[model samples]
Target: MTTPLEGLATIVGPGNMLTDPTDMAPYLIEERGLYRSSAQAVVRPGSTAEVAAVVQICAEAKIAMVPQGGRTGLCGGAVPAGLDRAIVIATERMDRIRVLDPVDFTMTVEAGCVLASLQAAADEAGCLFPLSLAAEGSCRIGGNIATNAGGTNVLRYGSTRDLVLGLEIVLPDGRVWNGLKSLRKDNTGYALNQLFIGSEGTLGIVTAAVLKLYPRPTERQTALIGLPDSQAALTLLGQARRASGDAVTACELMSRLALDLAVRHIPGLRDPLGTPSPWVLLLELSSSRPGGLREALESVLSQALEDGTAQDAVLAESGTQRQALWRLRESIPEAQKHEGGSIKHDISVSTSRVPELIERASAAVADALPGARPVAFGHIGDGNIHFNVSQPEGADKNAFLDEWPRLNRVVHDIVMGMGGSISAEHGIGRLKAAELARIKPDLDIELMRRIKTAFDPDGLMNPGAVLIP
Candidate 1:
């Protein structure tokens, strides 16, 4: 019987196969250093043809194939698990910008195209691809679509799924399903791309995609507003939307604890407003029409302050200053890493339930584990909050981690009770597969399993992810 490594080389060529464990070290582990699995080999396929060939070889050999993108994924989606003989199908080498149509306002790019490069290509053509994330500089568009990434701009532009016009998927059985369509409207059959948007590489591998584009904003306004709490932030978001109409692009909320960590840990970063408040709301408005955006933001902010909803606020006077204000908001996640080990809960509820969700989750966590610090923050405009808990001061790291499962149960229970999702923006990779199985309705699980079996009956694509055995 031929070895899995040798079988992969036969399809993708020996040059693309890495069998030595030392050279495969990086691909064996995940970004967060949480889960590690040994791969028999790592294959760097250069084209969709190569990917299909590799998949066919693996399926014939009864070996598992893990589809990997930029490796910046927070979930263990790209990470291998279980004792199955596996090979990672790395897509980085397939990077290419296939087509850019300024007239039709669309761009067709390969799965491995870096997210930042795609954004730059759109901007050069005087269009905007607004799926902005801090990891955009390193993350690939394939992983973004696979995870259905949600970032700050989601308030105005929606998630990656919203911007995707079409996709090219490689099925588990090594069949290349070329479903790439760039049209704006297609009243055809069911939208197949939607199935793979947040599938986490469970059903198929995304090889290329057709992405939508929008008119580039000519005028922009940004503000740093001080509010008393989450309740005030919600009120401010409503007021800003009322004032700016459709130009309200971003409304991000940051807690005082979040800001403190940014200042204490991250260098060259300070409060944007120069004064500390319990909470801050970063607001932005963009328009195709030039001028008056700053005035419009100021007018809305003035009303907030008069209503005692805002203590103070500042507007960016220039492009450089605008980026500076954004830098503070973007630095929160990185700055948080320096603090210590943390338990993260990316969840969302109805827009009206923001304040209640924060209050209930915080109280429950504190009650469950005494002295656990809540570092809750994120896109309040979209009803998603990263409800994180910092370990108690000087506590045993492993001991704190030991409580993770129970802690997750407490938090997730409250989330479900309130009619909220356990996993919001981030896809459920290996981390939450079991929890997902336990909590989701049986019919839902049965349907998902049926679909998985239909597309991947042999189960060659990212097995042990998004499903329980």
Candidate 2:
């Protein structure tokens, strides 16, 4: 009798199937190292047909499957839940750029293509694939689509769902649905692609996609502005947008603590101001046509400073300067790691209510656990903030992490009260599954469950991700 592992080997050959603990170590650990995944084997399928075959074998043998790509997800969505009869289907081997149509402004790429590679390909073709994140260098496109990722550019180019035109997915029962059309406007009945875009592989396995592209920006301006508070930062954001005629591409907010962490941990990164303020905004504006963008940005910052909305500001004068500023913004999460245990929240509220949300949430957490550090920052242009809380200095790491549930309630309660989403860019993987159920309306949860049942009745596709079984 052929075992399931041997059967999977037959589909992708022996070298592609990894059963050794050492060989599978990389796949078993989540990005944040918060969870340990267990799998019978890690199978790498080089093509869609091979993926289908592997899925078919797993389905027939009643083995649960965990679909993974690059394994850089912060939410533990790609990690398995230590199931005895589960296997990980990694898409790293399926990387390929099938097509790049500059005329059509679309690129057809396999799921495993690294996001940074896609951006380079777009740049080479005089186009821009604007879905970018800190982990773009290692994160795969499949995972981006699975989570409907929102990055700094989401303020200009929408989230991953908006950039994607179509997707090619392998269903739970080994059926392939090739809806890989590059059309912009398709009025055909029900839009099935939307279902799997942010499903976190619960509905099906994403193999490839048709992504929308835009014209490359010929000119850009970046500014790091210090504000008195979140409200002042919000006011400065409005000033930037109005001054630049709404050409602002990114507006990120960083608390003083977040900036301090970056400066302390990341070498060569200095505070942009002589005296740090309570809050800072990283503002960027771009234009395909090169004409007075810097001057316009300077004018906005000048007026903001005079009006008391901005305390201090520095605009990037060169490409190197712009990248350096961005590095400071991107290094917040990594720097937090050196500060001991951290509790992260990716929540979003209305644009106007962002200031209040930050204030209330920070106060609530401080009251709950005295001396806890609040490092709130992220894409304020779209109202999404990474409201992360660092453990108090000298506290036990495990004990701080153990308070995750209690902290989640305190933060999520305020988010729900303000009509904000609990999980903004990060999908509801195993981390927030219970919180999702607790906060969401019963009817909404029932609808999601019904949809999951319709697509994966056996619940064989990513059993414990997104929707709880």
Candidate 3:
């Protein structure tokens, strides 16, 4: 028998409940179209009280709940699958910037606020909330906190966990745990906010958060460099960091093939160097106190080039030029998608071991899939590599995707052998649950389960998500 969704809808209002298949289509599928499942209904809660109430009602009726934000997650974390008795509680209607304090250097915002908008609000006040991702325009603050996002700026600012000061969460029993404080120093007991930051909505529903901010960067410089390979790139990175001190904000790496895909698939993306190389690095340096950071950064790059660590270089001549370079980096994923299907891996190792990791893992993948083209790129400075493989030209996508499991095993084995992580910035949603179960030690899984049972014994909050049943 289908439980009456009408009763719950009455509390929030008829307009908030979406039961029609067409109306709930967007929420059912994940971003990459990897996971798709139907829901009993989709609910939009406008306030924290409404969220709590929905949780309470769901608990009473024993209906599972999935908390969804902007639905831009690469993982199937937000998608509802094999659960017909569940309703997606989207925080879309709760989009609001609650408060901003320039003096305290913190911004308290509702979970539904878009990341780009939050950054804009802070920028308007002459401050910066440095949590940035490719999906920043569409992804919500709640999801960012839930995943503990790490982006290009992680080398300088750290992850989303570091940016959060406090959080307001709605517990499984429909009670609100208000910890939304904007204080810089609070050494009180166990810091509860950290637990929910990367919990993926398995522990509680994060309704709002107090985020840290910093003084805006006054000057910025960006450059593109050609390196022999990952080792040369690493050497160049170390040199740049030593020369510029803390000014090297980002150090992203790319392969020649990856750049070619961007140039061919994405419109108006031109190679600034007007030449191709086997490997490249996109380095950006910024300083709050500066007349110009470009000269300092270019001098460092010049030294690297002369030292043979960097073979060729192109410094951004203007702000427009800077965005142009970044555009190629940002368009890599989409460009790859347009070209062909790929097997994606977001793995991380120590910054010093990145070159070795890439070499070993890439060779292993190549051996496993004979003609697969490796398209590895990402924040090398922070050791997070989006190691993906595009299908060979005019190859069958089904055949390429068929090697997903074997490909993942080969890469993950190397990552684990190096004391690294399979999922770096991205959390273990439904996509990596099997890998998490296999690679994660038995003791670690047991401890995580114990904590989950202690917090939510019924297994109601985002059931069958991180933990494999």
1 against 2, candidate with superior lDDT: 2
Local accuracy of candidate 3 as per-residue lDDT tens digits, 404-462: 88899999999999999998988888888899999999999999999888888888889
Off by over 4 Å in 2: none
Alpha-carbon deviation at 256 in model 3, angstroms: 0.9
For residue 192, model 2's alpha carbon misses the true position, in angstroms, by 0.6
Ranking by TM-score: 2, 3, 1
Q: Write the per-residue lDDT of candidate 1 for residues 1-469, one digit (tens) a residue.
A: 8865677788778878998988888887877778888988899999999898888888988888889999988778897877468889899988898999988889999999999999999999999989998889989999998889998889899999999999999999889998899988898888888999999898999999999999999999988888877799888777777777768889888888987787788788777665577888888999878887777788888988898888889888899888888888788778767767788888989877978988998899989999888888888899888888888888887788788888889989988988989888888888888989978999999999999998999877898888975
Deviation in Å, model 1, residue 440 alpha carbon: 0.7
- Tens digits of per-residue lDDT, candidate 2, 1-469, equal 9987899999998999999999999999999998897789999999999999999999998999999998888888898875677999999998899999999999999999999999999999999999999999999999999999999999989999999999999999999999999989999999999999889999999999999999999999999999988988778778778877788899999999999999999999988786588898999999888887788898988888898888999988899999999999999999999999999999999988999999999999999999899899999889999999999999998999999999999999999999999998999988888889999999999999999999888999998887777
Kindly report which residue pairs in candidate 3 clash with one another: none
Worst 10 residues of 3 by lDDT: 1-10
Backbone steric clashes in candidate 1, count: 0
Q: Write down the lDDT that model 3 would get.
A: 0.89
- Cα displacement (angstroms), candidate 2, residue 210, comes to 0.2
Q: Is 1 or 2 the stronger prediction by TM-score?
A: 2
* TM-score, every prediction: 0.97, 0.99, 0.98
